[model samples]
Each structure stands twice: as structure tokens, then as C-alpha cells.
Target: MQALIDQIEASLASRLYFLSIFTSLSLPDIAGALSSDNGEASSKKFIAWYEDWVRPRFRENVVSQSPPHIGQYIKELANPFDGESCYRFRCSLLHQGSTQHPKSKFDRIIFIEPGATTNVIHYGQINGALCIDLPGFCSEVLQGARAWLAAHEVHENVQRNLSRFAQRHSGGLAPYIVGVPVIG
Candidate 1:
């Protein structure tokens, strides 16, 4: 898990935000499965893990006011990325190669590229779509996952599942491949 986090962080450091974001979104799936008694991966596990860890790190909502069609102004909080929406986003992005989701609250999700200046735009709504800071979003997920891993390091389920978790072998895995760096 730490190795996975390190790769994501390295991508972010190299300004490879898309790569970082893509992999970061998959962390909940991996960690959630590890935390489960059965050690099985599923959407339910992913959403629950994300809700408990990553969701709290995000802003409550992108827009705090009612839409124009309501005919009257009312305070409303529509969270840009709830567990379901984020899960849908992950599916759409990882499977379809796009951010558009048929069942998403927003038609699309946009990630703002990091700029050289200190001032940054981290999260907001734009044209009914969620705009997130690329680096900030990636970092939040990674940080949350790291904390979760630390807290659950000693759990029996986690320990059991970790044996199957994909990781880099410094000198390759034994009895199959050896003498070079490889991921297994």
C-alpha cells in the first residue's frame, strides 16, 4: 500500500496529474477489499471505504444554492462527489476513458491543472460540472488512504489480504522471475 502511495506521489511530483488521479481513484477498491473479512473486492466495499475516508476530506458541496429551475432561492448542498457519484466516476473514467457518467449528478467532472503560483483553485462547480484541483484531489485521496492503512495495519483481514496485494519486488519474485525489478 505504501509503495502504491509512493508511485502516486511520484506521479504528482512529476506533474503527471492524470496518472496520479487515475491510480488514486483505485486505492479505495484495494484498501476496502483488504479491510473486508472475506477480502473480496466489490463496489459496496469501495463506496463504503471512500465515504469513510475520502469523502470527509472533500468540500460538502460545490454549489450551495438552489438551481434556477426551482423558481426560488433556497440554501442547498449538493456534494460534488458522494460515494455513489465517485464510484460512478471511477467506473466511467477507468472503463470508458471519459469523465462523463450517465447517472452522475454532474454531466462531467473536470480537474484543474496546477499552476506555478501559490494561489490555487481546489474545488468548485463549473457549468454544472465539478471542477477539482488535480494535485489537491490526488493528494487528499492518497493521504486518506495512507492514514487508513496505518490504522488498519494490524487487522487480521488486512494482514491476510496483503499477501495478495500487488507490489514491486526489488529483486523480482522467487521461483518465477528474478534478478531485476518487477511488479508482482
Candidate 2:
């Protein structure tokens, strides 16, 4: 029993370590795009920002909403689709039913980065498609993303170290692919 407990602890530690590293690397990439001059003026920039920021948030949500070991279980059960990265893990959770969204037409639009412009992703029931609109609540989401980015900027060096580590262990890292799911 003791050995089993130890093994569980070790495994949890390992997963958390990987998650931390992954989330750390993601923050900068998202932040960079949000802070970039061109990003400031474009709605597409918000998508790039959330591509990284949403994963850990979703993981935490899963852990909180589900059982104690649910996160680990989901991580183990996750099927790595070709070209999908850790960043897309959160989005996958939604699509895979591991994470549930509200039944409303637009579930929740989270602006992971605060103080940035809001860019909304609209989900229409007619086509069951996600339509990203720049004029609505999306503006709030962008603003929130910017705020989150500003709060975490002090960890820039941590991001650099994580990047170096990523380069060294690139094989184990997931690839980030951007694509909308086709709702048929």
C-alpha cells in the first residue's frame, strides 16, 4: 500500500511538473502576440493569445469540477491528434466532453488575458459552429487576456528557461495546430 501511495505521489508530481513547464512556455507566446503592435489591432491576435492561455485553465477547471484524480485520468486518456499541441488541450476537453459548457448559445467567453481588447467567439446553434466576432464580448475577453499577461510578465526569465528546456525535449512536446472543428 505504501509503495502504491509513493508511486501515485511521484506520478502526480511528474504530471504537475510537466503541466507547469508547459503552461509557463505558453504564457509568453500568448503574451507576446497580445503585446505585439500588430496584435493590438487585430482580432486574430486574441485567438493566438488564448491558444496558449486556455489549457491550464481548463485543466484546473477539470480538476476542480471532477474527482481528485480526474485530471490525471483525462491526461492519460487524451488522444493526441496529429499536429495538436498542449495548447489545444483545453479546447479538446470541451470537444471531448471532459469539460462541459453551459447550454446557452454562447457558453462562456473567457479572456485569459485581462486589459486586452475583447474578442468573442460566438457559438451558433443553427450550424453548431463557433463564429469568432470582434465586436461583441470578445472585446472583453481580449482585455482580460491583456491584464493576465501583464500580471505574469515578471516571469519572463522563467519562460526563457522553459523554452530552452522545450527545445531540448522537443520530441515529447505536442505540436500546436490551429483549426476549427467542422460541425456537421
Candidate 3:
């Protein structure tokens, strides 16, 4: 559970980092791309910016790879795929450049939306493509992990177990993971 907690914390930081990459705008870095007078930004340069904008589209990838121990501890996400399992989606995306599975239940996984909220993955037909909201999917994982941690926390026996586990992993005198002050 401690290790799982560590993984969740790491994932939170990682997703935030991924979020930064997702929202990054390369045009702002160039001298005159966003200038008031320069309306003729190179189309190729804009394409390059588009290339840089796509971040790691693996929030579902993480959910698919959830370990059994972690699985029991965390929230159970409603399976979203009709034609594909979570594992297959992860494999296809990781091995291939995009979600190019011909028989994929989802036509495309939505990585970036201008305004998306509510931590829920909604399936719908967009231009004949099955769309999955990336942030919403990741938000489900984050919420689940936090719920599990909170469930076992602020209790004497559980805290003791966590402390002992942390100590065992650290080999004594030091803490297991750096951020866990309760066990540190």
C-alpha cells in the first residue's frame, strides 16, 4: 500500500507535468510568431508547433497497467471500451504512434479539449469517431488513488503498519519514499 501510495503521488506529479506539456505553446517561444504585426506565421512552423503540442496520451495507459494490489486498494473505474479492453488500448497506443486500431471501440482518444471538466469519461460519436476525454480519464485515476489513501489514513493501526512498511523498505533509520512525512 505504501509503495502504491508512492506510485500515485508520482503519477500525480507526472500527470501535472504531462498536463504542462499538453498545454505548452511553442509559437510563444519564437520571436515574432505571436507579435502584433506578424500575421504571416509560417504554416510549417505552425505544424511544428502542433507536433510539439501532443503530450504523452497515456493516462488510460496507466489505468490499464494497474497492479492487482493497487487495484484492490483503489476505486474501480467503469470499463469504457466496448470493442477493446484497457490493456489492448494501452498496447496499441504504445506500440503504434496513435490509436490506429481498426476495430477499436473508440475512434480517437481525446487528449486536449479547450474546455473539459467533470472527472468522467464520456463516450460519444464525434465526426464518426469514438472520443475519450483524456483529462477526465486521468482525473478518475487520481481521484481513486486519493480516495484509497484517505480511507486507510488517520487511523493508529493503519498508520503503524505504514510506518513499519516504510521502515522496512528504507532498511532502517531512513524513510522509504521522500515525500511521506507521516512515515518519515
Candidate 4:
């Protein structure tokens, strides 16, 4: 869990440094913009780049496609959905500097409040759109990523930590002994 958290934190830092404000990409997530030969004209924007790359990567990266929708499986990558709607949201953000999706589905998927102090706040309304703190949305995505990491790799991480502990310190907690064996 700690490992996953740390990884997520690092990923966030990378996200900020590489993107967050100005996009490094000239063109994003569209056809015929990639060379596959070198790193020239590479993208550093998360939303746009993620929109372009996530689907194919989801198909090729994961072992199984049980739920089929990557968002259903990995909510951290794109919240509220891992489908076209979220992609549209990304498009809106990239092109419009806001997560306002013109379509009702996209609007319902994620409600973004442009200016807010707190990280997150759920605004209730009788006949208007629900307002959500944008910062909170980012935090929620991080939380989802952490959850994803834990769900997928907790056991493997534990095993790796145990092995490392055993190797690092002689007669440590690793290779734990349960009880004495009786002679047969």
C-alpha cells in the first residue's frame, strides 16, 4: 500500500513537472500525429495524452478485459468512466481549459466547478448542475490510482517486501516459522 502511494505520488509529481500548466504536445490523441520512430513532438499533457493512449494501452497492458471498460476496472486513470465521455471531457479540458462537456452524458459523468478554494465539495441543486471542486477531482483520481495499485499488486508487493526483508536482515521476520514439526 505504501509502495503504491509512493508510486502515485511520484507519478503526480511527474505529471506536474511534465504538464499541468502548459502542454508539451503540439497535437494530441488524434490520428497521424505519431511517428513511432523517435521521441520528437512527444506529448506531456496528461488529459489529452491519456485520452489518446489509454484505450489502446488498456487493451494491450492489462492481462484481462473482463469488464471491458477500462474505467470500470481502473477508475483512477479516468474517473466517472473510462469511455468516450471521459475522453470528451479530456478533449474539452485540452481545447477549452475546462472540463465542461457539451453533451449531457459528459456533464453528468463529471461535474467541474472552475473556481473553488477547497479540494473538493459536493454542491446540491434543485434545478441546476452539481458543482464539484476541480482540485478535489484531481485528488479523487489519485485516490483511485492508489486503489488500483493496491487491488492489483498488493500481494506481489508484500511478497517482494518479505523477500527483501529476509535478504536484508538475517533471522528477521521473513521466512516466518509457525510451529515445531512432529516426527512422523
Alpha-carbon local distance difference test for all models: 0.82, 0.36, 0.41, 0.39
Residue-level lDDT tens digits of model 1 in 28-110: 89999999988887999999998888876654222323355552443453345788988999999999989999999887998
lDDT per residue as tens, model 2, 1-184? 1222233335434544333322332343445443554332232443455544432343444455687765557663211111123234334333452222343233332222222446433222224333322222222233334556456545654344324332222233334422433211
lDDT of 2: 0.36
RMSD of 4: 15.7
Worst 10 residues of 1 by lDDT: 59-68
**List of clashing residue pairs for candidate 3:** 107-130
User: Highest TM-score, which number?
Assistant: 1
The TM-score ranking, best first, is 1, 3, 4, 2
Off by over 4 Å in 1: 59-79, 116-119
Off by over 4 Å in 2: 1-34, 37-39, 76-147, 150-184
Per-residue CA lDDT of candidate 3, range 1-184, in tens?
Answer: 4454355446545666343322222221221133213333443434342223221123334555778776455454434442123333444554564655566666655554425554443554566565656544444444443443565456555454444332232333343344334433
Decide which is better by lDDT, 1 or 2: 1
Which lDDT tens digits does candidate 4 get at residues 1-184? 3443354456445645224221312223221122222222233333444444433343332325445674356543323334354455556666877646777353433344434343444332224343434333344444444443345434543344333321222334334532443211
TM-score of each: 0.85, 0.28, 0.35, 0.32
Error of 3 at 94 (Å): 1.6
Q: Least lDDT summed over 10 consecutive residues: which range in candidate 2?
A: 77-86
Model 1 CA lDDT for position 54 = 83
